[model samples]
Target chain A: MLKLLTFVKNCKEGVLRATPKKPRETRRKKILQTALEILPQRGFDGITLESIADALGYTKPAIYYYFKNKDDLVCSLVTDYLKDAHQAICAITDGNGSPKERLIRIIHFYVDRNCEQRGYFTIDHHLGGVLRKMPHTAEADNLRKLSLEIPSRLIKLINEGIQLGEFRDEDPAVLGSLIFSLLGGVLTHMEMPSLASLGVEGLKQRVCDFALKGIVV
Target chain B: MLKLLTFVKNCKEGVLRATPKKPRETRRKKILQTALEILPQRGFDGITLESIADALGYTKPAIYYYFKNKDDLVCSLVTDYLKDAHQAICAITDGNGSPKERLIRIIHFYVDRNCEQRGYFTIDHHLGGVLRKMPHTAEADNLRKLSLEIPSRLIKLINEGIQLGEFRDEDPAVLGSLIFSLLGGVLTHMEMPSLASLGVEGLKQRVCDFALKGIVV
Candidate 1:
């Protein structure tokens, strides 16, 4: 009991010193979360630091402490979300399984992510507009690279599947683009009235079955 | 000599009545053509009556004579473009051919049309924003219906293919959505730096092969 108490006390001291209570980190996260929630409803241009602070019951200065402006806030939001997505992909791809299984897993992962991240994909066109307007910015370049990473990972998985004899021999680049396109369509059209009638599983099944059929040996 | 004169007279009369030299129609077409040309470069919002007039070498009043306002002008442009698309689809689907062959033809036609109509798909997001903002307009409703009609036709073609035993047994509605999504992706991505490298034929082949493989038994 004495040793347990010491250990706990030491842990508390270490956490306090090494990972101090960075309210700014928490504040920044809160700001990003609020912005993301507001993005689909209000759009990138519509979101202001004032709006974010109002949502958080904080002053506009409080948000300024974390972000220089709206553009900065958006850049952080995009880069963070994409980083999380990249991490999710790595988690799925790094696990023990056949390459074919990993590919399907990645597909399902993306579909599920798209559904969960409704505001992300729904505002894709809006995002494209934003990217185009700010093409020379480092943030824009990062966003572009992160977006390309998805298909890049997909191509790698396809190449792995082909080498393992788990899938038909085909051009990974072309196949990857096709798969990416299909998922992009799914992202946009999932909310269409006709497609919405398919329900989520029915919609996912169609994408999965069709994608798998295209390359299944 | 008498027969030739009569034929020439008939031809002149036919041309006079058939086309009627309606300056209004010609002006309307010119405005829409200019708008289509400028939309990608300047976007819908960037376009103004003054710009259209400047492009066509007409006074802004002349444009307003044909189109009551900018919204009216855009509505007409969308409706006219979609009508042309619908006609193109009809010309293909109405022709006598196996369902599979017709499907391939439709795919190529859409790809060809997309390549020819670069600015159209690129501005799709901008158009969506405009449509959402002006939802109650008849032109918006018509545009929505015309857009839906493409996928509806795709479903019909897929159904015919199944009935003809050319395609594997599957849900035509879902399959149609998948195809539409794939095509949408292809359209948007065709000009991406990576995809642009695919060239037009290379991109079309990827879309065609993947789509056919997905449905073909």
Candidate 2:
């Protein structure tokens, strides 16, 4: 009876701790989502801090509390996106097989997962423009560095496959670019309104199939 | 005296014919060159025909003399660029080779030629937004269709490769997308001022090296 009472009290305390944190997370996520959709249309050069806050019906002070400045807000949005994307890229070759098998798995993972995280790509679209035109603070550089790491992992795996003689001997760097081009092409068409109506899954599958043809022996 | 008179008459006629035509062609070429540079930075919505004419100290009417409208000017500028790009693409295939060799040649031609055509890419930047927001006019539709053809050719090559037992069988459409994405990843990086300083040739070489590893047998 004494232990049961302690367990009940602990469970109630846990709920109290989780409830406040959940809404804060929810609010931050909501801000990121809205920012992604709006900024791409107006462009980062054209967007203002007040505009973002007003669009969300939040006070300037509230946003100021989350992000010290507009740049901070933009960097945080992209950094969060890259971390998620980086994970998905690593997930591509997690299965076991010949190097060829591993690469095929990676291609599907890249396509299907990118299909799910389509929103993440807009962050990349704006990333170069922002970094090039805007000043490079630590946050901007960090975001840029983290973003490139996504492809670096895929390169690492292909390098490994080459060492194992699974892939044909060639410049690993060039192969990575060819594959990267393939991904860009697929994404471009997928995003087009003319092409988007074909359905995301169908397009994703086609992209995966294309990626495999180029890499598989 | 008669021979001297005849020589002067012939010279006068030749000078009259050459003078007007040469300046007209020179002015038209000058306008096109300035438009390519300015259009990329200001965007189609941001720039005006007046601005283009002013850049060269030509009258707005002079620009009109060469071009019927903004649409006509844009189309005329792109027509030559598209013709060159199409020729470069055609040069990629060897008529007969292993699937891998043919694909590699195609990849090589693209990277080499695309590097040279960075100026042309700038013109296409604002087009995505224009196409999305505007109705499907013939000019817009034509550009859109032309854009898709590059990848379609790549897809066809992949299909041929599979049929020849030179490549692992895979969907041609998907292969087209992957190569394009790989190209985009490289091209996007080149737009960065800091990285643009790295020179497109270097970037293309590295990106192509990395991409080939993932795709080549």
Candidate 3:
């Protein structure tokens, strides 16, 4: 009976310890979610921790406890986003069919992701300029490295495609870079008054077709 | 003798009137040139009238005499660039062999201009985001309209290409946008370490080839 009592007491203590962490995690996610929504419209300079806190109806200190500052919050947001994007890309590139097929899948993946989380990309592109001007931090360095890796990995895939005769024998480096530029341009101008009729899926199909034709034999 | 004296007097007055205006025009050009040099490196936020004056060894008041403020200065620079670019594009589109030939010429023109004046393009791109958050000014609105016209003109050309059956019967809007994205992607990543070996001419050739292949029958 004493042993049973001790076990019950330990179980209650364990739940008490675990419950606080869940809300903290939940709160951190909520902060990131709110920031993502505001970021595309306001940009990096326009957003403030106070603004984000106000949007969430939380106190400044509540946000501070979760994020060190605005940069920290943005870095966290980008890092989380890059981590997931990198993983998805790797899974696609590593677990793929022919190089051309993988490349097509990547185009679909990139367009779909941009369509869904355009704010992240707008902020990401803006961050490219912002990070260049600011003093380098470890976090900024990691973000830069992560951003470069995506392109380099795609370039590698393009190189593989060229070697296997799946793609035309063009400079993969140039081809890869051009493909990225094309996708970015589409994203940049996706909201043109004329393009509204295509919707997301239609836009994706056109982008994939255009991008593939440039590279295919 | 009286007629000769009168002619000399008129000549003297003409020189006196032209002298100060010449220097004033030259000084304004100098200010715009210096800002162009600094803007791509520092972006819109990092530049100021004082910093520009410092670079030019002129007083801040001297810059003020020429520009009302930073936005005014940037607007002037962009306006000058757009006017020239629009005229050049119009010339090419108007005096071309075929739509495909005209499109190829445009790709070359764009790539060459970007290579020569990379800073202007970079700052112009950064301004797209900056203009969005700030209160709308007439100057900003004009800049936005001018920027939109470049692509719209190209889209019109693509539509012409489709109608003439020189290019594939794809959505002209989609094709034009994708072509722009491809060229822009080239500009964005033109400085990548891997792409360094391909000189400007080589890069332009590759870009034109890739772009034309996508839309040409």
Candidate 4:
């Protein structure tokens, strides 16, 4: 426990120290953080780098030092979020267990990660139509590409299960896409009458059960 | 052949003449037809009575003769769309085919319906805010209700299949939601990059193969 606590304290110090360590880097991080937080509140069409800089108590040039433009800042936020998701999904999948157990844990982590970062959905995902001619356009495309990879890995598990005759045959690529839907279906109810009618735990179970039912031998 | 040809002409004439036949009613149908054509290009925010009227060579008051207000018009659209969807889904589900086949056909219809009516997804769909305190919000709320009903119906199908010993024992509701995701997964690829990769016919076949692989006996 002492060692774990020591390690955590060091980690926190490393993260804090990593920030504001360099003048240009600090401004970049600040700009990206501001974009990540504010994009959800105002739709993408309404956001400007000037507004983001003003919100952070910085000059436009200060932000320009960190990001080339508004889309660049958004691309960075999207990229960072994708990297975090990829790492989380990878950690869950790397564990040694039956695919069923692994997937349950992954689904649980997936939902928790979503709730933990619900703000990103509103910010980075509104309309999802970033303007062309931005330098980070390729990177933004890659972030979405990364988003697709997590499900691909999950589908790979289902494919393996089928090969072992422990699960029924299913198209893994399509199965991966469906898992994404099950994962996000509750968002469909956000505007409905009962906000709390279908709880998160219940929604997750629905996804897990849906996945297993189609495949169990 | 003569009788069949007459039946076809009669059906077409009936659709055209089933209208309220009132001069005022023509304005309403004209408005809705215009809205369907233009709204997808411009989103909910992009539509207004004046714009629709301009497109139809009428004045705002002329359009209002049919709809009370913008809200009334939207509610009418929602009601009409849902009625059509319910009818389309019901036709497949009325004991005409096997459970697996019915599920596939219905799921295909749901996905295809969206492709044809991309207007529903053009905006953020923030109805919680849109419907708040509005008198006609019930129409939009019903759309939300249908989201749940859709999965519930699928669960019923899975339960029937399992009881008939066609599928393995698994939770039905969960499976139903999964089936939704399998089809719902198409939303992620609406933009040009992904959209171009998935040509129209390519997606239809993908949905078919995906559904059968998951549920085939």
Among the numbered candidates, top TM-score falls to: 3
Give lDDT tens digits, candidate 2, residues B17-46.
447568878877788888877866676666
**Models sorted by lDDT, best on top:** 3, 1, 2, 4
Each model's DockQ score: 0.49, 0.25, 0.56, 0.16
Residue pairs with backbone atoms closer than 3 Å in model 3 (clashes): A181-B185, A182-B181
| Candidate 3 C-alpha lDDT tens digits along A127-160 | 5666575458887788788877877789889999
Q: Between which residue pairs do clashes occur in model 1?
A: none
Per-candidate iRMSD: 1.5, 5.5, 1.5, 4.7
Candidate 1, residues A1-217, lDDT tens digits: the string is: 9988977887877553445457647767878878877777676656788988988899988789789987788778777777887888888777879887787787787777667766666455455666666657676887887867766887888888889887779777767767777888878778776678877677777787888877778
Better of 2 and 4 by lDDT: 2
Worst 10 residues of 1 chain B by lDDT: B119-128
Each candidate's B-chain TM-score, in sequence, is 0.77, 0.72, 0.85, 0.70
Once fitted onto the true fold, the runs of candidate 4 whose alpha carbons sit more than 4 angstroms away are A1-41, A46-69, A91-95, A123-128, A131-158, A187-202, B1-24, B48-72, B82-112, B120-129, B133-217
CAPRI docking class of candidate 3: medium
Better of 3 and 4 by lDDT: 3
Cα lDDT for residue B122, candidate 2: 58
Q: Write the per-residue lDDT of candidate 2 for residues A15-131, one digit (tens) a residue.
A: 544465677788878877778767655666666668778899999887786678887787777678778777766665555676666666665665565566554556666655666
Name the candidate, 1 or 3, with the larger lDDT value.
Answer: 3
CA lDDT, candidate 1, residue A6: 78
Estimate the lDDT of model 1. Answer: 0.76
Question: Given the true complex, what DockQ would model 3 score?
Answer: 0.56
Of 1 and 2, which scores higher on DockQ?
1
